[model samples]
Target: MAGAGEPGREGSGQEPLLVFRTMMRRLRAECPWKREQTHRSLSRYLLEEAHETLEAVDALAAAEDAGDPRRRDAAASHLREELGDLLLQVYFHAAVAEEHGDFDLDDVASGLAEKMVRRNPHVFGPDPVAHDDATSVDDAWQRIKAEERPRAALLDGVPATLPALLLADKALDRLARAGRPVEDLDPDDLGDRLLGLVAEARAAGADPEQALRDAVRRRV
Candidate 1:
């Protein structure tokens, strides 16, 4: 009694969505190893796939620089494949969540949608953003975020697990968003400070994070 719309059929059944469900079912049924996976076990695979995707993006940029049409096309295909791998990781994670009865892909999607709507009041609601200085827009966004989270510490939102360079960038961005007077520091002085810190890190064989954290702790 298989219908056209059914999986492997023509009509009269629920249309088989070739999406997360199909992938999940295939993983659960056909893939014995995929069925045995837990979130903790799959974390490394997810990170590896993400890094591969980043590599593909970097390759695409390099191909663009060379102006090779064939390389560019190949890079694009690689990028798409890498992205699909990343999407699979997302679905795999969602499947794990579904097993736990916590939340699934729909919840993840809905939560992101809600967060986007909440954050982008200008885009989604009546209060459209006015044309202003970049600093002003950033300040307004931070203010909105602060109102939403109401964190005790200013650095609460920055992910601690981010790479050191990215973490430092986020920290600086947060400070800038809060209207800190970085303009007061001379460009030469800033350059010198950064160079001196790099030299010190090289000399001491110390992590820049440790040095930066110590300095922040002393000041704060």
Candidate 2:
């Protein structure tokens, strides 16, 4: 795998991975507060940073819609700051890993490199797959993944902590992956079900999240 600051440049001469490492090292050495941070303490910051990044993306879209170049630059600046905040979480995690002699940022990066190569056999192997045949690559990726975690169930990988809408999407996706028959839902019936739920929520003056939580609590 390529090191962060290797020769032969792209875009800028600086490598982003190296830059991240340098920032991490500086934070570790120069900042007392940063040095004292733990994974638990940094969790909220990571979530906040991710939301900020999404907000910046939204701002960029709004700016483009309004034809405002200045807003574009402001949005870009916000994006950079948000990304830095996210990187800080990585740095904090790496520091914790280093303390425990588990693994550091480098190990994380190298593992990613290995996974990428393993997933994309077309790029790394002699029998490169045809570019037009995306299904072939997808099949290969799934087969390789199954081999890697032989004991894991089909639905084991999706996180239970995701938002309800996202979790629903993931659940549906996993079902599709397991070759479940996709019988078409009647749009009129689906609309009626959704509208009834909305009406019930409004009648009860209920927060949808709380209602969903309650439903989930009962089911689980």
Positional deviation of 16 in candidate 1, in angstroms? 9.5
How would you encode candidate 2's per-residue C-alpha lDDT over 1-220 as one tens digit per residue? 4454432322145677676676676677678988888888888888888877766776676677679899888888888888887877887788777868999888988999999898888898668776567666877887888788773665588778866544554555455668873355455796545544544454465545446654764576
How many backbone clashes can be found in candidate 2? 0
- Give every collision pair in model 2: none
Which of the numbered candidates is closest to the native, going by highest TM-score? 1
Consecutive 10-residue window with the lowest summed lDDT within model 1: 10-19
What TM-score does each of the candidates earn? 0.70, 0.67
Clashing residue pairs for model 1 = 3-11, 4-10, 4-11, 5-10, 5-11
Candidate 2: regions farther than 4 A off: 1-23, 133-140, 182-220
Candidate of highest lDDT: 1
Query: What does the lDDT read for residue 195 in candidate 1?
Result: 43
Instruction: Give a tens-digit lDDT track for model 1, residues 50-130.
Output: 889977986787798789999999999999999989988888888888888989888998998998787776778687876
lDDT of 2: 0.70
Q: Candidate 1 — which residues are off by over 4 angstroms?
A: 1-18, 132-139, 179-220
